[model samples]
Target: MANGVMIFMALYPLRYLKTKVDRLGKADLVYLLTTSVISIAVTAAVVVTLQNGITTYLLAGVASLAVWMSTAWWVGRSRTDAPGTRER
Candidate 1:
């Protein structure tokens, strides 16, 4: 159990999710977390495909992370941004 938590803690995207927990509320939290996991998996695939060198793979990871995080945040915000609805 301890090992599993430490592995999850290593994911920096979860840190961003952590900061947004209060404002995002329960529903969006689930969305963001699921998105975060998908982002991690996709990033790993891209990094593995590169396989050129450490520098290239690292860049792939960073670039993909930026794209995924941005898209997730934007989608999450739009979903919660209806005229009659407000983040809680």
Candidate 2:
């Protein structure tokens, strides 16, 4: 859950930078770092609550990736359909 939230939070500014600057700059790095820290904290909390060892971590990773991809797809579709937005 925390990993998903961190990635979701990071995605907006990263996408914005990609569109406006054509490259990731310093702000993007900061966003990534922040996301990493948040994700680590969340993952730690989850690990403490689970008893299945590596399987729990694997499941969490898979779920987080799914959430990230779904959110990215939704955001990409919305942006493309908006007036004056360019298709990628």
Model 1 misplaced stretches (Cα beyond 4 Å): 1-27, 82-88
In model 1, the number of clashes is: 0
TM-score per candidate, in order?
Answer: 0.52, 0.40
Pick the TM-score winner.
1
Candidate 1: pairs in clash = none
lDDT of residue 39 for candidate 2: 48
Residue-level error in angstroms, candidate 2, position 27: 15
lDDT of 2 by residue, 26-69 (tens): 22334444544454555555666785867877766665455544
| Model 2 misplaced stretches (Cα beyond 4 Å) | 1-49, 80-88
Task: Report the alpha-carbon TM-score of model 2 versus the true structure.
Answer: 0.40
For candidate 1, write residues 41-66 as lDDT tens digits.
Answer: 66667667776776755675576567
**What's the lDDT for all of these models?**
0.57, 0.50
In candidate 1, what residue range of length 10 has the lowest lDDT sum?
1-10
